[model samples]
Each structure stands twice: as structure tokens, then as C-alpha cells.
Target: MSKYIDKQTELKQAMIALRQERSQIYDELKEQVYHTSEYLRPSSILMRTLKDFNKEPEYKTTVITSVTSIIGGYLSKKFLFGKSSSAIKKILGIGIQVFTAKLIAGKMTHH
Candidate 1:
């Protein structure tokens, strides 16, 4: 009867240690997730730049015109090439130009 009691006490202690270790691991994982989310939040620069662009009158018009031009160019290229690879190149070129223009405008206006 004494040996059985000793074995039960040992098992109880091991279970308690295992539960403590699990709790510690859970807390560590929670902390890591919190820190990671904080790091992923948008930077001040991006927010400020977006705010500045929103205040501009020409920004929206420029964006609209850029989009329209890309679409028009793509249609024209498709009509000209009739689904050839060259048409794809033209569409891609228009897309790249619009993207580059937006990036340049953003940088210029922000700075």
C-alpha cells in the first residue's frame, strides 16, 4: 500500500509539470503572434503618403486616365495582332507604364 501511494504521488507531480510547460508554451506563442502583428502594421510613411495623395485634385483624374489608357491600348493591340504574342507584349507594356507612372507620381508627391 505504501508503494502504490508513492507511485501515485510521482504521477501527480509529473502531470503538474507537464501542465506548467504547456501553459508556458501557450503564453510564448501568444506573445510571438502579438509582436508579429505589431510589426506588420502599416508604416507612417505609407499612411502619410496616402493622405497627401488623397488631398490632391489631380490624383483621381490621373489614376482614371491611366486605367483607361491601359485598357484602350490593350484593346487596340488585340485588334491589331488578332491574339498574337505581340499583342500580349503591347498590353504588358501599357500595364508597366501605368504602374511606373503611379509609382513615380507617388514618390514625387510624397516627397
Candidate 2:
């Protein structure tokens, strides 16, 4: 009967230890979930992206190249088409603009 009592007491202690461990693990998981949610928020993501973009020189170069290409394309279209009212001429002008932009951007990248 005494041995039986000892075994029961040991089992109870083990159960208590297991419950404490489970609680600690649950709390840690909850904390991790909260942190992950904060990190994944849209504002957090946008801020991180902008920070990285500002820090990188390559992004600045890319932006400049893109803007210059677009302006060059616009100028070429205007110079060629003037103020034409023909739908066909307008469409052709747009095609020429795109071609000019691509060509300018490509040349800029190579040099």
C-alpha cells in the first residue's frame, strides 16, 4: 500500500511538470505569432521596401534610366507626329514612342 501511494505521488508530480511545460510552450507560441503578424502587416512591408530602395544605389539608377527613357519616348513622338488628328497617325505615334523608349533604355544600360 505504501509503494502504491509512492507511485501515485510520482505520477501526480509528473503531470504537474508536464502542465507547466505546456503552458510555457503555449505562451512562447503566442508571442511568436504576434511578432510574425506585426512583421507581415502591409505598412511594415511598405516601410521596409522603401527603406531598402532608398539605401540601394542600383534602384536610383534604375529610376533615372526609366524616367529618361520615358521622356525621350515622349519627345520623339511629339517631334514626329506634331498635332495630327488622324487615329492611325496617333496609334503609329504610340508605337514609335514605345520603340524609342526601349531603344534608349537599352542603349543606356549597355553604356
Candidate 3:
């Protein structure tokens, strides 16, 4: 009877060890699924980009400056330019305005 009791105790200890191992394996599989799952992977790129955009202060400003320069150049060429004006002159004008705007913005941001 004492031998049977000892055997029962060993079985119970083994079962507890098995249960703990199972729990750890379950957690590892859950983490693997989260990493390789299709639904999470595609959206993760956008999420990461948005996260980076939110985290980085300079990225948004740089994009805004580029877009603003392109729009400004187009507007200036379309409205401020005369039909008879040379293409080279128009381009130079746009370049000058964009450069000046960037310089002013840089100065403002620095101060």
C-alpha cells in the first residue's frame, strides 16, 4: 500500500510536469500563428508605416514640403506664366521659388 501511494505521487508529479509543458507549447504556437498569419502580415505593413509616421516627426514634414513644392511649381507655371515665355525661364522661376520656400521653412523650423 505504501508502494502504491508512492507510485501515485510520482504519476501526479509527472502529470503536472506534462501540463506545464503543454501550456508552454500552447503559448509558443499562439505566438507563431500571430507572426505568420496572413491577415496580420499585410495589415502589419500599413500599421508599421503608420506607426513610423506617427513616431517620426521629420517624415511628415518632408512629404508635405515635397508636395507643396510640386503644387507651387505647377500653380506658378499655370497662372503666373505667359504663353510666350520661354520654358527655361519658367523652370528657373519654379526652382527659385521652391528653393526659397524650403530655405524659409527650414529657418522657421530651426528657430
Candidate 4:
């Protein structure tokens, strides 16, 4: 009867230890989940994407091409049809703008 009591006590202590370990593991998993959620947020994802983009070797060229393209497109429109109110002229102006932008961007990228 005494040996039975000792074995029961040992088993109880082991269960308590196991419960503590399980609780600790659960807490760790919860913390990891929280961190993962934070990382996956939209703003966080955008920031990470921007950071990766900035690290690329072509980042400077890409930025310059985009800025130059927009400027070139706007200037083409302004120069070709400044303050024109004709529907045909407006459509042609938009087409020229897109063409100019694409041309400038393509030339810049090739260089």
C-alpha cells in the first residue's frame, strides 16, 4: 500500500510538470502567431515590398524611367493640344501622351 502511494505521487508530479510544459509551449505558439499576423498586415506587407524594391539593382533606373515617362507624357499632351476642346483632338492627345510615355520609357530602359 505504501509503494502504491509513492507511485501515485510520482505520477501526479509528472502530470503537473507536463501541464506546465504544455502551457509554456502554448504561450510560445500564441506569441509566434501574433508576430506572424503583424507581419502579414497590409501596411506591413507594403512596407516590406517597398523595402525589397528599393534594394534592387535597377531601382534608380526604374524610378527615373517612371518620372521621365510621366513628364514626357504630360508635355506631349500639353504641346500637341493645349486647351483644345474638340472630342477628336482630346482622344488624339491622350493617344499621343501614352505613346510618348512608352517611347521615352523604352529608350531610357534600353540605355
Candidate 5:
């Protein structure tokens, strides 16, 4: 009976750890999906608009042109706003890379 109880306890602990790891992986995947969708959303919209225009050119030129202009404006803002958001993103990416490298170095030194 005592051996059975110990085995049960060990099984419970193993299940708990598995659950925790699964939860962490789920959260990370959700975050990645959200960020990826955000990055792709504008392009998706542009593609849909183009597809619609191709299907119905006669009915869509003016509307498509307007939407295209809007998309162009948005892309322009993304890359060429006065401060240039693209530049900022590049700088931020470099900063993150540097920070990550430093963190890895610190961890290695600690070991």
C-alpha cells in the first residue's frame, strides 16, 4: 500500500511538471502567432484587395485605387514617417541582439 501511494505521488508530480511545461509552450506559441499575424496583417489586406480588383476590375478600379492609396500611405508611414519607423525597428532589433548576446555571456561567465 505504501509503495502504491509513493508511485501515485510521483505520477502526480510528473503530471504537474508536464502540465506546466505544456502551459509554457502554449503561451509562447500564442505570443508568436499573435506577433506574426500583426506583422502579416497589412500585407494580407493588400493581397486581398488586389485579388478582389482582379476579379472585378470594372467595378473596382476606383475603390481599389483608393484602397491601394491608403495601403501605400500606411506602408509609407511604416518606412518613411518623419522619424522613419523602419529605422527605429532596425535599431530596436540591433539593441535586442546586443542585449541577448550580453545575457548569454553573463550566463556563461556565471557557470
Candidate 6:
């Protein structure tokens, strides 16, 4: 056979190999895309979220801290300043201060 004929034969084989490889790559890509779509379905996403929730402490800490803080606030407000005569004296003092401020503002506006 001539050299030109052999070169043409080699080019044809190379082109055929390249086309097969391209088709294989396309099939692999399509398969991967289908698998990815299945992986991201709603049920799959929910399962993934549940898995992550089991692995994290966000919900636990949020519940514990929220209840503790609310109870602590109520208890402190009720117990810190108990119903004693001294507490009554403090409340009366605050009322006097507010009354004096209002009297002063009224006098200023009168001028």
C-alpha cells in the first residue's frame, strides 16, 4: 500500500476512537446528572436535614437557654426586690422624683 493510503487509514481510526470516547464521556455525564437529581429530591433533602440536625446542637441549646433565661428573669424580678418596707420606701422616692420633674416642667412652660 502507498504511504498516503496508510496515513488516511490511520486518521480514520483516530477519528473513530475519538468519537467513541466522546460518546462514552457523554453517557457518563448524563448518568452523573441523573444521580445528582435523585440525590437532591425532596425526601433526600429532608433526610439530609434530619441527619445534620442529629449532628448539631442548635435546637437543644436554643430550647434550654430560652427556657432558662425566661424563668430566671421572672424569678429575679419577683424575688430580688421583695415586698418589704424598704422596697416601699424606694418606690415612694421614685414617685416623688417623677412628681417633682413634672412640676418643674409645668413651671418652665408657664413662663
Q: Write the per-residue lDDT of candidate 6 for residues 1-111, one digit (tens) a residue.
A: 699999999999999999999999999999999999999999999998878867888765555555555555444444544444686755765555455545544554455
Task: Go through the candidates in order and give each one's C-alpha lDDT.
Answer: 0.72, 0.96, 0.75, 0.95, 0.67, 0.69
TM-scores of all candidate predictions against the true structure: 0.42, 0.65, 0.39, 0.60, 0.38, 0.49
TM-score of 4: 0.60
- Tell me the lDDT of model 6 at 31: 100
Model 1: per-residue lDDT, tens digit, 1-109? 9999999999999999999999999999999999887766677557766788799979876776666656655555455455445766767666665665566555555
Off by over 4 Å in 3: 1-44, 82-111
Candidate 1 deviant stretches above 4 angstroms: 44-111
Candidate with best TM-score: 2
Compute the lDDT for candidate 1: 0.72
Model 4 alpha-carbon drift over 4 Å, by segment: 63-101
Q: What's the count of clashing pairs in each model shown? A: 0, 0, 0, 0, 0, 0
**Candidate 3 local lDDT, 58-109, one digit each (tens):** 9988777666656655665555554536878778777766765676556545
In TM-score terms, candidate 6 sits at 0.49
RMSD of each: 8.7, 4.3, 7.7, 4.0, 22.3, 17.8
Evaluate candidate 6 by giving its C-alpha RMSD to the native, one decimal. Answer: 17.8
Q: Rank the candidates by lDDT, best first.
A: 2, 4, 3, 1, 6, 5
Give the RMSD in angstroms, all C-alphas superposed, for model 4.
4.0
* Selected candidate, larger lDDT, 5 vs 6: 6
Q: Tens-digit lDDT track for model 2 on 6-100?
A: 99999999999999999999999999999999999999999999899899989988988899999999999999998889999999999999999
| Candidate 2 similarity to native, TM-score | 0.65
Cα error, candidate 1, residue 98 (Å): 8.1
For candidate 2, give the lDDT of residue 51: 96
